[model samples]
Target: MLSLPRSRSLLAAAAIVATVATAGSLTYSLGLGLTPCELCWYQRILMYPLVAVLAYAYYTADTGIYRLVLPFCVGGAALAAYQSYLQVVAGGTCTFGGCAAVYIRPVTIPNQSLIAFCLIGLCTLGLAVRTRRDRT
Candidate 1:
């Protein structure tokens, strides 16, 4: 088991990842003028709050912050996964028009969001598991 400070550091790292994802998506929309699709909006909704909440929890050294982050990360991952599926299978036939899967190379917003959601979700799960272990 990691020390409390080490656990908090991991949470802070998760917060950072979430914040970067939020910034990237916001930049794609606002800075580049590329409108987002429904799944994108869903992912953003889940990603945005984590930046604030996780940061606060990290600073407060909240050992149980995983409880707060799990739901959002899971929902975000689901939306991202769905978006990714639409990109691959539907081939840009998303409900809100379409989604892009290749921007420059072969990385798209949906894919990026999925990666971020997975990372954060797993991190939170690790924290939850470790916390439970400590309690026992």
Candidate 2:
């Protein structure tokens, strides 16, 4: 079995999360014929590029890429969290589709996106910590 360095492994994990989130969103909108709301679109904007960004960072073994990626993760997380708030708390309305729409019963799309963004953020933070510790 081949084991990767912690930093590289964390980048790979983040890349995987981004890929799955991107794929799942695409599946929901394109395949399942579910229309995305405005907030969903914003979350997608933040999430879709992470697939390439994290993958390229992993390919180049650039641990410092966290500086670039973390903002996007944070933005995505904020958007997802807000959407969740709208759906669950505020009973808000979106310009595009319905923010309150829930296809997976208990778990809304924004909630799932939130999980993915948070996971990617955590992995990136872990890599940052590991890189810093290694440097000192």
Candidate 3:
């Protein structure tokens, strides 16, 4: 069974992932010379809220919210995975203009996006597994 501390720890990890993802987006928007594609923007939308939702769930000690939050994380992961494939495997040209045009070369792999998705998925999955283990 998962202890309260353990559940909290899982939530904390999710929160950290959310925070890092948010920071990464801001960094890309500000420091890094790259504009987000439509899919990237959608992924960001999903990621940004996770920080608040997970924190809220942890603070309230309500695991029930996972039903709501997990789907968002999953959706974000799927979108990120698709974007990564398009950027890394497909090797398509980014014609969005602005900094994106300069930064994302046709040859550049979207490993960073994939990493972000993996982090989010791993954290969320950890929480779900811990919750299930606690139940059993």
Tell me the deviation in Å of residue 93 in model 2.
Answer: 6.8
Model 1 spans with C-alpha error above 4 angstroms? 92-95, 101-104
Kindly list the per-residue Cα lDDT of model 1 for residues 1-136, writing each as its tens digit: 5578878877888999988998888888898788887778878889999999889988887869898899999898998888778877877556564555446245777888999999999888888888888887
Q: Global lDDT for candidate 2?
A: 0.85
Clashing pairs in 1: none
Note the residue pairs that clash in candidate 2.
Answer: none
Candidate 2, residue 29: the lDDT equals 80
Per-residue C-alpha lDDT of model 2 across residues 1-136, encoded as one tens digit per residue: 1124777889999999999999998998899888888889889899999999999999988888989999999999999888887776645444357844654666878889999999999999988777777777
Better of 1 and 2 by TM-score: 1
Q: Which candidate should be chosen as best, given TM-score against the real structure? A: 1
**Least accurate stretch of 10 residues (summed lDDT) in model 2?**
88-97
Pairing residues by index, what is the TM-score of model 3? 0.77
Q: Give, for candidate 3, the lowest lDDT window spanning 10 residues.
A: 95-104
The TM-scores, one per candidate, come to 0.91, 0.90, 0.77
Q: In candidate 3, which residue ranges exceed 4 Å CA deviation?
A: 95-110
